[model samples]
Target: MPTRWELDKASIYSTKAGEKDRTYLDSAFCLTDDVSTPSRHEGRQVAIGKKVLQTLLTQLAGQGSALSRERTALVVATSWSDESYFVTGVSGKTDAPAGFTPGEQVAELAAAFALGGPALSVDTACSSFPYALDMAQALVNSGQADNAIVMALNTVLPPALFLGFS
Candidate 1:
């Protein structure tokens, strides 16, 4: 049987930097990545989520810590009804008629990471992040995984969001 990890809600927000856990105070928004790098995904296909997921994995990877590919889980919090218009002008984009569910989206992103842990996606509107945290916590607590990486993201901001700011 796998080890039952005692996880904290803020575990992903902090990292082990020496003897103590360092809490991150820096906040980032409106980030963009130049997709010039090769993807680690199997088949090395230049997919939509591969590059972004790789960029986000930097902090957890290469640390040589207890968290292994098999022990860590992945949870993505996004609206099920997120932007569907970005299908055009982008590669690896899937439209609504296709497998356009949040679960499938996260599953693809999870595949890019090549991790063997449990992976899932949650859509709870504004409460998504919190809901995702709960689901991630449950995954660890239930011995499904040792740890989890929670990403609250959207494919693209819908027009309604911009209109609200206007």
Candidate 2:
């Protein structure tokens, strides 16, 4: 028999000005600077993803410091994966900068949240979120973790892609 899984809490941060909450999904037409940082390795997508993860984790951990515990897992899904889109296109660099891969982003989040469980990043374009959620569900159902944090991030930081499409 499969075990039952439940979502205790959720958070979302988008490029849109009014779509910070999931309830206002329709307000994500125009992209905005929801998560902008000056860090070299961190881009808009990573920043937003980190914010969402932190919010959800903080809610789950409460005031007792559940984040320090190792009973939770993190699964992130994104199309561009990391800051490669910006690094390669805008900077015209031939190599990816440090902490630009999907796996590295996961590691950074794990370290920041002090998560000790398994961390994975999935990239399947438009279907990445669903795939990540499925993976997280399996982890919980298999008794690998008591809770799982699933995140989906997408951003068009570099103007090349947007300009090209336009």
Candidate 3:
């Protein structure tokens, strides 16, 4: 089985400089109106997608989704390593800024909700989100865990990635 949410190409928290300069290329985002700052790492990280996951988590928990409680484990399907640069884009494929890491941040987010399942960071670039979902579903289907949270988060418009677009 498969489930997914692909955000349409639109501007939710985009900076005018990017759009106007033709340098900003961001994917559709799921964000809270309250959090309205255009993130420098809009496509690779700190994009509106995180807000989308949080919202979905809340809704699922409210509806009693299998992965709502503390017993549920979450496997984060990510592309860039926390050690990768937020401003530098995805790490494995390229070099990012110094001291930028995601492992600690991922753990912190999971801990904030008191999650008990195995917390992991997967770096599959572009495919991170769907992969994460698949991993979560597999865990549930295999009965290894009651529920799973797979988070796919990435930002865009990095200097290196621009070549692909051009």
Q: Could you tell me the lDDT of residue 19 within candidate 2? A: 39
Q: Pick the candidate with the highest TM-score.
A: 2
Q: Pick the candidate with the highest lDDT.
A: 2
Question: Per-residue lDDT tens digits of candidate 1, residues 10-129?
Answer: 542333333234334344475443456322221122244565567667755656443577778898887633233233223353432333456666776777677678888888877999
Worst 10-residue lDDT window, candidate 2: 1-10
Among all windows of 10 consecutive residues in model 3, the one with the lowest summed lDDT is: 1-10
lDDT of each: 0.58, 0.64, 0.54
Estimate the TM-score of every prediction.
0.59, 0.63, 0.55
What residue pairs clash in candidate 2, if any at all?
Answer: 15-32
lDDT of 3 by residue, 1-166 (tens): 0111122233222344444323344555543335564333333243344565568778887888636455677676666653234434433334333433567546755676677766667667778787778878877788777877777655433333443443
Is candidate 1 or 2 superior in TM-score?
2
How many backbone clashes can be found in candidate 3?
12
Error of 2 at 17 (Å): 23
**Model 3 misplaced regions, further than 4 Å:** 1-50, 64-68, 81-100
**Residue 39 Cα positional deviation in candidate 1, in Å, after optimal superposition:** 17
Cα deviation at 77, candidate 2, in Å, is 1.0
